[model samples]
Target: MKYQQINKSLFETNRAKFTTKMKPHSLAVFNSNDIYPISADSTMPFEQHRDIFYLSGVDQEESILVLFPDCPKEKHREILFLKETNDHIAVWEGEKLTKEKAFETSGIKTVYWLQDLGKIMFEIMTQCDTVYINTNEHYRANVETETREDRFTKWLKNKYPAHAVAKSNPILQRLRSVKEPIEIDLIQKACDITEKGFRRILEFVKPGVWEYEIEAEFIHEFLRNRSKKFAYTPIVASGNNANVLHYVENNQQCKSGDLILLDVGAEYANYSSDMTRTIPVSGRFSERQKAVYNAVLKVKNEATKMLVPGTDWAQYHVEVGKLMTSELLNLKLLDKADVQNEDKEWPAYKKYFMHGTSHHMGLDTHDYGILTEPMQANMVFTVEPGIYIPDEGFGIRLEDDVVIQKSGEPNNLMKDIPIEVDEIESIMNG
Candidate 1:
């Protein structure tokens, strides 16, 4: 982990919140994500499961957290099972967390080696009437691979068929959506790093620069600032590529007059900060580009204000659609007749700006939140609104992460990053 150790108190509070929602005599388990393989000898980087990291702050692979608040034995109430570390392993794979360090990393005192998991789980399974299994129930989730959590769940269910099964996703969805003060600070750190990267690109971007070169600059800034990697697969789409929506093939050359859509962010200590900023390849937007840019910015600003407490997520988007419709009409892209004759299922504005304006932003890029529920304070969301015009040869998107406030407008986490037309141009030309 390139990031500094998070305070154990955050994990402690998260575990307390989760346990409170569990049924009596129930034990919830969270597993670390597997280091996926790419080929025979190579493997994708290890990323700790966000659920376990949220509750226990255990960032290493092959780790497990179990919470049994009603356990008869006090020490067994909260437990951590970690891969055993020793001097030999330390030389080969760097320092793995020792039992003492595990206690410091997580607040759980009862730590055991991974080999003892079956024996310890068997004992706890007998005592608990219900077992809470962690599952991916995020709204946008379309998982194809069987994760470590899946295998562990299958094993546990097979071993203890009589135990009542319960889902941990619902409880986690609500709990993880709302940020704790410490979690908010970590996310701020990520947004701050992203600001540095965006600033770096502003000066580096120019005609003939490859999109991948811009991607490299962002990663360089992120790594130096302790962000392990991008919050998600970065989109460094230049010109017409931006209209593709999820264009990650950053191989195109940025033309002199084209706009480069940078849908990028940095992840610090497993927390995500999502941001999207489209800028001119030549450091100056044409009159038409400027008009579209300001329109999208207008929609983003208004949409952010609607993220106050008690706002419904679905209704918020509908209102945002209305805001965009007005902008599109002013842009002359949509006429009164177009909107009147448009299908209700897919609004007239969908022709240009299609994606949702915001989503929960936290540990995962598309973080967990029940969209049917009303917005709440401390919940973070990305206010991104874009106008894609392949006919005009460019796309414009401006996004900022914000915290829903108790009153007035939500707080913009990326406020320090330049977003205005003149500011971005000044920095690039200066």
Candidate 2:
């Protein structure tokens, strides 16, 4: 891991909170993500399963964690199963966590090799009446691939047909939504790294530069600063390419008069920071570009203020629609009749500002949070508002990751990244 070691207290506290919600005499299991294969002799990078990493701070593959708070034997209450390391693995794969190192990384004192899982699980399943299975239930989840956790769930269910099964996703969704102070600090560090990348690009961007060049600059900055990689696939959309919401080809050249939308961020210690900023390829925005940019900036600022505690997620978007409507009318993108006859379901603002203004941002780019629930303090969200004018040959978007506060306005994590029209222009031309 390129990032520094996380304090095990966060994981200990997370496990305590999760165990309290489990049914009595129930045991919960979490598995690390698999190293997926692309083809023969090649595989994708290994990413630790967020749930297991959240609870145990174990950041390796082929690991499992078990929690049985009501177990009759104290030693079996919390256990970690890790792949045993040998001389061959030590020489080829560098290093694997030793039993002592596992204890230091995770609060659990009991550690066993992966080969002992069957016998130990058999003993524990006899003592527990219920089993909690970790499943992916994030609102945006569209997983088609079977995971290690899924396989374990199937094996456990087939082996113990009489045990009651429960879902761990619901409890995790709520708990992961609210940030612990340490989590906020890690996220801030990611945002700070993203700011450095953005500033570097500001000086590097110029007319005739390929979009991929700018993408290269960000990754270069991120790796040197200890970030493993981007939180998500980056978007370096130039010109009308910004109109495509998920544009990531990054193959086009930035023309002199075109607006390039950079939807990019850096990740540190598995925490994510999301940001989007549109800048002129020629180092200054034209009058028309400046108008749309300011409109998007205005909407982003007002939408951020609405992210206070107790705000409803769905209704918050509705209110943001109203703010965008007023800006659209002012921008002459919409007229009086367009506003009056707007559909309640779609709204007139959809013509200019189409996507949702905010989403939960953390370990995952689109982090875990129940939209049906009211907002709470320490929950982080991204306030991104944009006006995509494809017909005009350019699009503008400005986004910043923010933390909902108990009082006053939400805290902007990208506070130091240049956003103002003058500030961006000066930095680009300076």
lDDT tens string, model 1, 1-430? 8899889999999999999999999999999999999999999999899999999999899999999999999999999999999889999998889889988988889999999999999999889999999999887889999999999999999989999999999999999999999999999999999999999999999999999999999999999999999999999999999999999999999999999999999999999999999999999999999999999999999898899999998998899999999999999999999999999999999999989999998999999999999999999999999999999888999999999999989899999999999999999999
lDDT of 2 by residue, 1-430 (tens): 9999999999999999999999999999999999999999899998999999999999999999999999999999999999998889989997899899899988889999999999999999999999999999988899999999999999999999999999999999999999999999999999999999999999999999999999999999999999999999999999989999999999999999999999999999999999999999999999989988998899899999899999999999988898988988898999999989989888889988889999998889999999999999999999999999989988888999999999989989899999999999999999
| Candidate 1 backbone collisions, by pair | none
List TM-scores for all candidates, in order.
0.99, 0.99
Q: Flag regions of model 2 displaced more than 4 Å.
A: none
What value does the lDDT take at residue 400 in candidate 2? 98
Candidate 1, residue 405: Cα displacement in angstroms equals 0.7
Candidate 1 Cα outliers beyond 4 Å, as residue runs: none
lDDT of predicted model 2: 0.94
